[model samples]
Target chain A: MQPVLQWENVSFAYDGRFEINALSYVIEQGDFTLFFGPNGAGKTTLFKLAVGLLKPAIGRVVLGERPLSEWKTLEIAKYVAYLEQEAQYIFPFTVEEIVLMGRFPHTASQFWDRKEDLEVVAWAMEITGILRFAKRSIFQLSSGERRKVEIARALCQKPKILLLDEPTNFLDVRQQVELFETLERLNREERITIGVISHQLSLAKNFVKSAIFIQGGSVGSAGPPEAMLTPEKMSEFFGLNVSKVSVL
Target chain B: MNIMNASNSNVIARSPEGTTKQSQIQRLLRPQLGSRLAMTTGISPGKLVLIIVFFVAILFVTFLVSLLSGAAHVEWGTSEGQFILMQLRLPRTLLAFLVGMALSLAGAVFQALLRNPLADPHLLGVSAGGALGVVVGSGFLIAGSFVLAIPVLSLLGSLAAVMVVYRFSLRKGALSLYTLLLIGVVMNSLFISVIVLVQSLVRSDELTTVLFWLLGNLSFASYPRLFAISVIIFTAAWFLLRQARKLNILSFGESTAHSLGVPIERTKKIIFLVASLLTGIAVSMSGMIGFVGLIVPHLARLLFGSDYRKLLPTSAVLGGIVLILSDSLARVIVIPQELPVGVVTAFLGAPFFIYLLKRQEAKRVI
Candidate 1:
């Protein structure tokens, strides 16, 4: 089978200043790919392109052998779910209502949420351990809890691929561990393709199968995490000291 | 390894309990039958019941007061009283109700679409459009024919103003709420100036009619005009209610609505068109009744939640009742001479509006 996601020589720019040069990468089925870069390295922009939210200035984004432009957004939504970094709740919707919105593409009409839709939402919530907060207003939830609810909403779509942008940001240490563990379990058990953009190298090293290091809007290295994430490469790309120390 | 197995077994054993607890919680969280019934029509049962009872009571009292307490001071159930009630009070009451429903419903839709608590039909240039039309129509008014010219010109003017605002405010196929509001304010000011210029140019005799119309009197409301306005208001209300779900999604913000497959452009167009029509019709029927639209929707939101399903219908019904009571008081307050219904609405609604604002601030602070 073709790679679950492919970015071929993609280029993007915003307002003519910050630009992402020609970039190419492939994410195989069931791969936990971590995209590592500093702030403004076009991490969010790349995710946006992958999810078809933004069109590349050059080249193309392909999913399951189909070009991003060719697939209807609702159809694409069935295969890929995007969790934005900011989990802002603009309306006073309950947690259940927000989760049910994930099933909107599958809903027959705007008026009703069917039994199957509720069941899927319930399952997603259960997996995220947010089933107990179903009736709580999203605005009332803590940042970590709201992020979990957002992930639950993405999972409710039953997408084959998940794209997350800084999912660990604003989360407590325990919450971060819980989220990473959840992602690991989902990837291993469900065989879901996952792409995450993160600055946390330690967490990324533990979870991701591969790494793509981006610097100055261009790929620095793309290979197996163990081989690509060396001390010298880390120092060169991030301009930081790299040292390993025993925990105990 | 033994401890891991034991913990794993504990997790498996606790699964049924968790499921049972969730089901129980779900049952408790489910809305009651009364709430469900309320939700079906897009308003809470408690508010609906209160509105229905208030409407009936207000209607009866206003009708009785309007007939008995006018300049004629006609006794209840007498021949003169019956004639006044049938000929004047009844039509005025119907006009008040229709205008109130139209303005309030329009206001609710405006607030939802703009996502601003301060939005109202009058604030968005529709009232000024109607006022300009009425002022222009006054120039063509023949003796005893002011009624025909007023509604026709008012409706035309309102439609024209709305079209101008909408055309100018749209950018890249989307209406920017801020631009729309700014254009509305400017257009309204320009239209008001034109109305003033027209009022100055009219003959002294026509000036009284124009001034009364501008002040928004329902004293001239006939049975036929009342019937026409009633039909228009009810039709507009039904159209808005049908689009309630779209409004609900819209309140969540445009991008989210679009992602959920709601055609944002089409929905906005339909809402703006229908809401403008309702405002125009209301303004044409009763000259520039302010604050009913501005205040009633907020009141409804406070009484019920911000859910449009409940918000729209409740606003409409409560709006009608508020106008009826206001109109009745307008007629009876001075006894010999009546006050303008617009003045009454502003007088009553402004205080209620302030109270609501303070309450909202208090809620936010807490």
Candidate 2:
């Protein structure tokens, strides 16, 4: 499969601190990839670079074959949808309303949402199991429901590749299982490329096909999950004893 | 559980009465095209349109009621009474409505643009700058056109303040909210000090007019002044309305808005300038009406959901209603001794605002 997203010699730093230097990686089409790393490992930064939210100081991030700099931000949004970790808001927009916002890149010029836009939004909500609460205020939903709402929103964008930063962060075990199951179905059935930043080592191993291990600021390893997430590798990178952890 | 029920049989469609007996899969596959705004807000477009029209009708009725009732009793049968109705009360009433609309709309836009719930028109210090312009401009001859000089000078002053804030608060191409608000507070005090210095320098006779204007008096509103302010205010409002969707996305936060393809800095700057223009015109016309700009948007948000598309128009109409009623009360409450409308708004808005906050809390909507 062709690489859907590629970062070549990418380097970025915030105020000359917290740097990611000479980091190169690729997310191929139809790949269910896990961005596995510890805290402050620059996984989120790499996701931002992939979505073109932040430009690299040294090198280029390419979407398909074109450099991200060549694509307009709005045009980039059409192909790559991003969901930041912890989507917080003070407003009381309904679930459907929040989901419908995903179509903004397509519907920005129109005065109102067209029929197809509404259909896509409905379909997204349905698949994400948020259809019933479509008219409910997002503020009223639990964290799991809210995550599903946001996922429905990203799905509504009909993006070729969806990038989520720590989507399972606040979800419980059952909800986590449900979320992973849904993601697995989407990857296998819809064939949308997926890149998730996660620390749920055992649970994510079941859903992810390929795992990209990031340590410090660069890729420590990248391959199938079984090879990459070995006991020795987990102990080495995450500093966690493999025997102490209990799996559900 | 709710999702299961929805996907099973009771597929929610356009309206309750119109839910066709279609499978959930088919329904999701081809949803009907209806009012998109209604689809989001759960209020149909026709009903939403009617709600806006009803509020406007209420505003017109309040306008007529205000025109008829004031401190001076007028006999409808007499030509003198008709003259007072047509000339003085009409213009003042209309000015109050327009100023209210300008302030409220500006407040709503400012809140959205700053992404701060507490942001108001005066938070930018534009009003203080306008006050300074009125005080200093009053002293100039300006080809003996004192009337034209005041509004123009105030407009220039507010724009100057905006330019200074815009220039200083921008850090590395993006506007910093903390810096913008900090500069605003500093400029407000700075302008107030200059106004006091100018006030001491002016003759005693001119001092009273400037002081009364500062306290928010509408006694001098005339037809020409009213016409000019209305034109500018309506145009600015239309411009802000065009930015409603982008403003809605902006409420999601700056990064999210940018990711969704909103030109963040450009949108922020354009909204800032236009909203400042509204504030400048409002201050130039009505002096510093304290609570209308700050509290009226909150009231509108409570009444209409936090959607800017609805909030903008609702705030305008509700602002008009609140100010018109307050101005009428200001005229008659003291019986020939007029309290400044600004004083009444604070007195009225505070209690009513608290009451609404309590209700929202009870509903758990906030």
Candidate 3:
């Protein structure tokens, strides 16, 4: 099968002064890819490009052999679910209600959340272990719980690929482990492609099969996690001393 | 078996924490009776029916009172009474209903679109625009032709104000709610100043008419004027109701709504245009009736929750009822002489609005 997503020499910028240089990457079907970077490394920008929220200034971002721009937003939504760094729920939507929004791209307008939609929502909630809080207002949930609810929402889309930005942020240690384990289970059992952006190298090391390191709006290194997450690359990309601390 | 026992004891030891967890779970799972009843068969339907019934009842009583209790003491069963009822009181009551619905609906839409709790029909400069139009139409152009100038000038003024505010608020194909509101405040002040300046220049004879217009008297609204306002308000309400879903999504913020495939630019333009039209027509007919628009939507939301599907329609109906009653009260409170409908709405709506605000604050605190 063709790669699920491909970025060929993609470049972007918020303004003319600061720009993301041309960078090429590909995420294949069932691949668990982690993108790690220092602050201002364009990781979020890359995710935005993949989801077609932002257009590439140079070259192209292709999903399923179609240019990102060419794909209808609703159609692209069916194939890829993107979780932004900050997910804001401004209204008082229940967890189930929010999860049901993921199915909006597929469901008919009058049939907002029919039986099949509810089944999918329930299953997604089950997998994410947020079924207990399904009826609770999203605003009432803690940040970590809300994150799981969001993940459940994305999972409800049943997308071929999941793009998550800082999924582990604000999570407790046990919650972090649970989240990573859930992602691993989804990737292995469902064979879902996953692309994640994170600053925590050790956490990324455990979860991702392939890794990419971004620095100064450019790719510093890209390959298997073991090879890309070296001391030299870490020190160079992050501008920090790299010394491994033993975890007992 | 021993390991199971050990863990079971551990679980038992943590019983209090587990109970608290369970209690929280129970609290979340338990359907809120108030909201459920409110959603299913609560205040909305009840209020709607009551409002309708009360409006009709009050309208009938007010019509009778307006005819019989006036200086002439017209008998209800006589031809003079019937003529006064059909010609004068009926038109005024209908005008009051239309004006109230228009103002409240405009206020609701503005508050939702701007995401500001304080937005009202007059606060956004549309009322000021209508006032300015009335002043210019009566004072300069028509020279005391209040009937001819009322609709035309009000519409022109409201449309002008809306366009100015919209243009000022737009930045990169997006409108900032805060900016729009600030611009509205500034434009309202400016428009009011211009109205005042015109009032200062006009002869004393025209000043009384201007004051009456400013204070929002429905005494001059004839059958023809009521028909015109009815047509405009109904048309505007239909357009707004059709866009209710888009408005619901808009409450989620612009970027999020866009991601969900809502054509943000198109939706915003339609809402702004329709809301302004509604406000303009209402203000032109009734002058600046203050609190009905600002308070009615919030009350609807509080009673029915923030689902615009229910909120918008409920607000329109309730608004009509509120205004009709207020208008009736305005006519009856002091016999012979009458109070402006605006005065009645403000006196009633402001206290209810403050009560709602306090209730919402208390809910938040809890």
- The prediction achieving the highest lDDT against the true structure is 2
**DockQ scores for all the models shown?**
0.22, 0.44, 0.17
Q: In candidate 2, what are the lDDT values of residues B236-326, reduced to their tens digit?
A: 9998988888888888877678777787888888888899999999888878888898788888776677777788888998888889999
Clashes in model 3: which pairs? none
Q: How does each model score on TM-score?
A: 0.77, 0.91, 0.80
Backbone clash pairs in model 1 (N, Cα, C under 3 Å; residues 3+ apart or in different chains), count: 3
**The best candidate in terms of TM-score:** 2
Clashes of each: 3, 0, 0
* Ordered list by DockQ, greatest first: 2, 1, 3
Tell me how large the interface RMSD of candidate 1 is.
Answer: 6.7
The sequence of per-residue lDDT tens digits that candidate 1 reaches over residues B1-366 is 444443443343335433666545544433331132123222235655786787677667655665555667667779987887788777877778788889999998988788776788888898899888777766666757876778888889998899999999998777877788899989999999887887677656766776787777777788888878778778878878777767866765665455444556788888988999999988888888889999998888777656676678878878887887888888778877889888999888889888888875665510
User: In candidate 1, which residue ranges exceed 4 Å CA deviation?
Assistant: A1-91, A97-103, A108-126, A130-139, A152-235, A238-248, B1-79, B136-144, B193-220, B226-232
In candidate 3, position B207 carries an lDDT of 60
Q: Assess each prediction's global lDDT (C-alpha) against the native.
A: 0.76, 0.81, 0.73
- Lowest summed lDDT window (length 10), candidate 3 chain B: B33-42
